[model samples]
Target chain A: MATGWKYRTAEAETAEAIDRRCEPRRPLGLRFALMRIRVETELCQGHGRCYMLAPDLFYADDDGYCHPTGERTVPAELADQARRALMNCPEDAIILTEET
Target chain B: MTDAKKYSLEPPEVARNPHDTYREIRDNAPVAELAGRSQTGAVTLSRHEDVMRAFQTPEVFSSDPGAIEIGNIRPLVPLQIDPPHHRKHRKALDPLFAPKQMSKHEPRVRELIRDLIDKVVDQGHCNFHDDIAEPLPSTIFLELLGLPVSRVDEFLALKDGIIRPPARSMEERQEKVKATGQKIYAALEEVVEARMAQREDDFLSTLIDAEVEGQPLSRDDVVDIGYLFFLAGLDTVSASLECMVAFLAQNPGHRQRLVDEPEVIPHAVEEMLRYESPVASAARITAIDTEVNGCPISAGTRIQVLIGSANTDERAWDGPDEVDFDRESKKHIAFGAGVHRCLGSHLARMELRVALEEWHARVPHYRLADGLELQFSQGIRQIDNLKLVW
Candidate 1:
């Protein structure tokens, strides 16, 4: 069967990232990739899956639309959460990109 | 006549399933125009990406003209109003479906389902929709709205008319649909005025007494909001329940799975909803000139997002047409997307899940009554008289 729902950019490790353990264990010993989370607001249907499912990284608009608040870029420590929100988005409107 | 020529959103038939037509358009003409004089400037987005894009960009594709009910141009609260106003309405209304409310009422909902099933269980046969699916959701919703229990049938008629009116001339059907809407609106208006005089414990009374923008809402605001709830919350859950049951009765393997492993019912419900989306397309008016899938659409154009087709779009799902309860990531736009998404989604999910659990506990072995037919409503895609026997 076709694998899971994450729609990622070319640079991010698509298959390997799904297996990576990023359970928010503080004090990383090694360097982590910088991640950027975005909602192609035009494609977001505001299902609240992204915000409701991943509250730490997302909060809904007053209109219950996109959660475009807080640090637009996430530290390596929070990359797992950003990925969860990426998979959770029903509209597939949420995109995740990692900076080299 | 060709399929396109013969296609009517509301055609008169005993056992018509419009999804077959939806599939035809989705494959050949993903952005097909409405074929009649009545549907004039309307276009349906059969592709999933296009449907998602239209709703996600509400600034360009507004629900103001009407989302659920057509030409309801007067703005039916959050349902028909675009954002800013729509957000405020949702802020006030969305919390009503809080988990606390469901925790308090779900046991009661389960009891209600059992009692209704008990009435027909001994007969060894029953019309499933009328017996349980048709009445359960409406009963719970009306009780929430605090509408009198004695007037269930009356409100049921009004709700059904808005969603699935009898197939007739475009002018005639539109007239009936609007008139039904007016009756609902007038009912809310009367209640809002009365509640203003003296409050009650019902949701409507609370809404009447509530404030937005640090100012009390006008009668129109409360009434229109209530009217939208009446039209939306009334028949949608019931329609979904009916659809779920119809599918279960025919597929013994899936039915047995649910009965054997009750814990999977919630996931099963999501799969059922994805496979059989109760509502089809929701309407949006183009607020500005836009292009969907490269097809240029002018401002004021009516875009009907084919939600049913989008759920089954191969571009999104692994096997879009197959019903896989165990499938990973079952996120479908059955309730819609964006700020104008279905406000009653939480309630609908609870009801569908509870209904499945309670029914299987009692009548786990029921099957479609032999020689009987399953006829789904054209507009809302609901089964009215699904006969089942154990």
Candidate 2:
């Protein structure tokens, strides 16, 4: 039982480490790199304007709420689109975060 | 006095001194059970803290059953659903209304506002609601949704039926609501189908292809979402705009302030929203028995969060009744709070900001026509017929 428990714990830790390493690469040296858009799951009311404005960057997952496209570097051309997506969120669910 | 006894959801006179009645309720009974023989039987939370708390916990306060019943038209979008589910829908649509996204349409919104204002600025006398307030937001909404401009009248008529039912009896009201809702639903269904077939770059197409939980949203889901956007988008903004204009007319000093310093318009819009909230009470059902303030509320009790009243609470704000454009720390419940806050808040703000800036730049001075009786509807409390002359 002890050996089996140890094996299970090791497997869980290995999986978590892999997830951490495989996480999408955030934009590097981006001006708004630290800007975090926090989405409040509860308040979204889903008017769909966010997806309508920036389809390439933001897509609604199957549940009908928006999620950012995998961490691709914010291209210079799409920065404005990102800003619009952040600001236009009707529920004010998106919050911009600046990393120190 | 407990909120349980002080206020009736139905005010004494629809138009007369609503603020005072609200104040009475807020001070006397923060959460008063409003006897409902008319619409859905529900209670009201008039105090700032109480209303704020209700919005904060949406699981207990669902925005479902449609804010005001309009027959079979169920709210299919994010607002009606509880958390987890609500989050997904909100995420899917947030980008469309972002401030930057709205900037692309700013020029058009300004043009529409200018055109509407131009029609009556010269007349020097016109019903603000009919000539300007009603048309401006409706036009903008149609344009944004990529709907046909010609359907504006039909949309407005249907909106009115749902918002302020004129049918003599509840049954009549329900029937009218059903008829109007059916028209809107059918129109939306057709628009969605056409957009899907054409595969255009509009909101409809985006919604058609949007995936949730790895699956695209259903066609019926798209219609329900569109219906919410159509119904809630225009009227709320128009009402708020009407209130802003009326307040400015009554206070020429503030009007002059905007004319002199247009930069203050954004802040001024915040003040107006706080002063006269367009969307009044949003409904929520308690998921569990909760204690708010000191009162114990049972699970499943319907609570109506009176946003307008909460915005004026002296506890949260200083000189709460006065519309001070420069008020620092102007956090308000006008757009609601937590996850269920208004999604189009930024767009609505932009529209109002531009409208005020342009109006003050052009018209400058205006007044209410003498002997004109101001009116108020059930859900919204503001001047129904504002006659302005510049």
Candidate 3:
């Protein structure tokens, strides 16, 4: 469950702006956390679970290995799906992070 | 150092229901010496964590030729090759079996399954194994390999000769597998030679032109890759179909659910694959000294990672024995883990899902023939006489 949010000073502002644009449904002032999705290609055995579960966020290469589809950063709307892919990957290869 | 406990995997009962023995081994001895197989210095790892560790650390737990004898003269391509080289071969092969590529076969697979069901539906009872399970995947596999579908029986016989050799002793088993291996090689050679002379739009011809590290694969490499696929593509899905259908026939409640809500068939297939892992154990050998839970294992020792055990280990699940389709996380190493995981998984999953969907739609109410005890063959777990009645 190490979300890898330690180095947040650099990308946090830009991530928040992207999240607001992608997820306008988010309440105006309460809080905004930018989510990121990544696949550790080395650990990924091309199980294809990430692409199988979260098609919008991931697509498989010719080798069946996963690559982020649109952007590495996730919108709030797709957070549940990103988590689903992370949880179901047998290799535990999917990395999900939240930037505050 | 803790002495390794002895566990026998040869008992008929164990083959019928291995989870109980797996549970005992995990609780009492996570790493137990495999007895009764007539193989020395062999051990079984039953714990999920240990199994995963062994798979991930293939540098220590190597899958070279010495791992287990399947009567191949050389290490099967991609499967026996360690990383770097293995990655290259897989890169050339994975795309051919990728989900998108496999999805193209969905229509054919469904049509085949429906055709098989058509022959059996009118009958009050049918030997689901012999009638549907065995033929479906083998036919598809033969077609994929560009081999003659008319020769499926011959190919299946050759496959069974190696997998379920009807021998009482290890020497006899090896001898039989070796002889059968020669026949398989000759058969593959004939096909590869023909394909080389006149290429076709199939897996064999594709592999002929495939490259690894900027060089086209040698003829031997193509044959070696075909050898692996010949065994893999024919058997695993068939065994899975047999296991799943047998389970459903016995469990009326679960079957009714599939009939009621077809969307759940995929999840149900995942659960059954975990519960009755058809390819129960995967073999490896130690390239260097290794230890399992503090027990020392020297180099060259044989290891059998019990995927069935890991799928049901209490340490890995809340109720390990229960089969729940609603599980939020259904991750299991039934197809195996690491780089050598089964390459045909997507094809197998699609076939299973479609077969179940069509079967439940046609014959929703069925059960195991009364007084029949399913005799699942060891290793692959195919129930040759899985009769069911509606």
TM-score for chain B of each model, two decimals: 0.93, 0.93, 0.98
Against the true structure, candidate 2 reaches a TM-score of: 0.78
Compare candidates 1 and 2 on lDDT and give the better one: 1
Candidate RMSDs in Å, in order, are 6.1, 11.4, 5.9
Candidate 1 C-alpha lDDT tens digits along B1-390 = 013544456553522555666677777777767465445557778778888888788899898754344424378887888876776767777667644355468887988898998999889999888889878988888888877767889988888777767756877778888888778777777777787898888888888777887788788888777877887878888888888888888899999988997877877887788888887778888989888766787888777788888888887778777888777655788898776778777678778888899899889999988877778875467787799999
Per model, how many backbone clashes are there? 3, 50, 0
Which ranges of candidate 3 are over 4 A from the true structure? A1-30, A69-71, B1-6
* DockQ list for all candidates: 0.21, 0.04, 0.29
Winner by lDDT between candidate 3 and candidate 1: 3
Candidate 2 lDDT tens digits, B1-390? 143543555653633346777787777777666544452445678887777667766666667664446544666587777777887787678777765576677898899889987877777788888887788888888877878879898888777877776878788888888888888888888999899888776788888889987889999888888888887775888888888888888899988988997877766787788887777777777777877767777876777788888888888778888878766534676877777777787678778888888788878988889876667666665456788876
Per-residue accuracy of model 2 over A3-99 as CA lDDT, tens digit each: 1100011123443443343345665566554443445654554444455445544554433355543333434554565566566554566555556
Give the Å shift of residue B124 in candidate 3. 1.4
Model 1 lDDT, residue B11, Cα: 57
Q: lDDT per model, in order?
A: 0.73, 0.70, 0.83
Shares of reference contacts reproduced by the candidates, in order, are 0.30, 0.04, 0.53
In TM-score terms, which candidate is top? 3
Candidate order by decreasing DockQ: 3, 1, 2
Ranking by TM-score: 3, 1, 2
A-chain TM-score per prediction?
A: 0.61, 0.52, 0.64
